[model samples]
Target: MSYPRRRIIQTGGALAGATLAGCISVSDDSSDKNTSDDGSGDGKTAAGTAQLWHGRSKGPKKNLVTNVETFGSETNHSVKLSEISELEKKLENAIPAGKGPHLFQWAHDWIGEYQPAGLLSDQKENLSVDIDSTFTKAAAEAVQFNGEVLGLPWAAETVGLVYNKELVDKPPEMVEEMQSIMDEHHDPSNGKYGLSFPIDPYFISGYAQAFGGFYYDEGNDKLGLTNEKTLKGFRFVRDELAKYIPKDHAYDPQAAVFNEGNAPFAINGPWFLGSVRDSGVDVGVAPLPKPKGGTPKPYTTVKIWYFSKKMNQGGKNATAGRKFAEWHTTNTDILSTLAEEHGFIPVHKDLAGSDELPAATKAYSKSVKMGEPIPTHKHMSSVWDPLKSAFKKVVKGDQDAKPAFKQAEKTIKSNWQ
Candidate 1:
């Protein structure tokens, strides 16, 4: 079998099950804090404790509780960070009837799936977008669906150039510069090389976008990777860029090369900061250089703090709920704490003024501001595996880039079932 064909056939897997909502009524009690109505009962949390429904545990959970406690006194909304393993199912049943917490945290990609179902409110429905004036344009846009803002953008991450600062004083600003540095500094005999970016779709897709390419057309709802620009990018990576990549490479060895300083540059994201930092290498992080002024827009994943549509009823309780979300989401001190304590990428402006920025937080901010938000379309869930197999084949010289991508496109289109 062909390489991609064999890989695709060998890569059978399952997608996550769809979360379902049921017909559950709201509980009405005068003292049941998170009551179901707009204002019939006291708007306090259940038994005087406000809650934040999250899937996080341990360190993340502790950090959330600390931040919430900092501002919980502002609205008399004593809160706790509760781990709900069945988060989606529980929120689905609770929000409609108004028994859910004032706030919940989830990924921005789920905005499309939940927005149409009325689980969340427009960002401007209970609060003003003007308050979010500090958010990056990409961060602000990530919370929107159709034409309305869905929630407040929170922690985010995107791919960037992670380099050995000892090898390169500054990040290259263009593709030519990167190439020049590689040609001058790369020495295979000494275990020193210029670039160690793996030849994978997840990483290369960013460069493809920078060179004017996309896998799916957002507006047309169709595959968009067959164009000339995309082909140009593929050719560049497979031919010219391939020279910098070692042969027969896989993720483990590729990461080993960069971490060991055999290669100075790796295209990776903030999540890898811990591993890279622990390697004890002097590393520098910055946005991917624009090649010929082309944008190397990385894929960004955003975590949002959403207000429950059922909880914010435009009453005194609702008013307090909004204040709670604002206290947690918009406060400079709270945001800095999340950054310093949890390594979360703060979405607010003027983060530089804060003395608490972690090394990873500083490394991640620029790309998070400039990269593309991961698409929320349900079909996108089927995209990654097929593309991963194809990427390996193209870089190994086992298949041409265009044909590899075409085959993966067919697989994704059919695999969504």
Candidate 2:
């Protein structure tokens, strides 16, 4: 029952190199057809042919694509999977030219950019079933832009506290409780930190969520970065960064510290579970700790399959894309198999309580219960940079939380409006 240890595959540089060498090719035959038989009776001609692009660098993407190709053949559809880095550039170029793949796997936030460019379809009409009922409400919210559902969730990821069972006999229920335990047990002499987190934007996003802060206040249409509650959250993390973490470690290396057994706790995702196990660490996953008065919540990001608006308008191909996406995400057998093998949560709620999930994944599922989706606004990506920079300054002791947040609030407000 042992699985292959997952590695990061140091392909960032290689992918860039391949992109520079123009290692992308588009099939010129627009008359070929790829079909799948999912028994939904939605056999429509794939517009000439349907093309799919994915960044299957590691873990779930690699395995999921393999399963899709093997099982999806019965549904009369074909998928062309490629490395993410190369496909990113290919998608950017093809999307503008209205020649992109029928469907693409991307982060939830990308809906903002693609929706404005008219590159994504409205899921309300084309989908065979009710989109909202198929997945978690959070998953549905993440794929929407303004009021339109732009994509169907393929998989979901969220941050959670991964702790070494040997270090923490019982996981603390509150942030203060964890801090007290760390203060008493943390052994700096042995290179063991109580916690580790990167100063990167993604980590900041999760911290904000745990503190019950959101990037934008949709109700008031104002930036939430400078609110008193938000500043409190930033200060909480900064204090922990100073007291419990090593000076050399930054946010990106947070998981590495835990994997190397240099830290007992880290805020990360299921993707790191296999790596930590491979590193010989007995890791236990739990929901991110909440502040003294706040509830534990993680910023959940959904990995979704979005159809290009152009593809949807391309006639028969659009119908096929819709059918393919619906079947792929809604199929219980496919979702259960992928979740069990790939270590990701199934989007379908029915599979949430399935016995097929691993213990670690089941632990993460609790966090998913309290997860908050990334905002589906047009300016969300632009706001994170300033917020992350502000957090880093506070964490590094270069600035106080109040001032750093004020600056970030200004930046976020400007872009948000």
Best by TM-score: 2
lDDT of each: 0.64, 0.65
What shift in Å separates residue 188 of candidate 2 from its native position after superposition?
Answer: 4.8
Note the residue pairs that clash in candidate 1. Answer: 210-295
- The residue ranges of model 2 lying beyond 4 angstroms of the native Cα positions read 1-29, 32-49, 86-90, 144-149, 180-190, 209-213, 246-252, 313-320, 341-343, 353-357
Candidate 1 yields a Cα-based lDDT of 0.64
**Error at 373, model 1, angstroms:** 3.4
Candidate 1 has a TM-score of 0.67
RMSD values for the candidates in order, in angstroms, are 7.8, 6.6
| 257 Cα displacement, candidate 2 (Å) | 1.8
Highest lDDT against the true fold, candidate:
2
| Candidate 1 worst ten-residue window by lDDT | 6-15
What TM-score do all the candidates reach, one by one? Answer: 0.67, 0.81
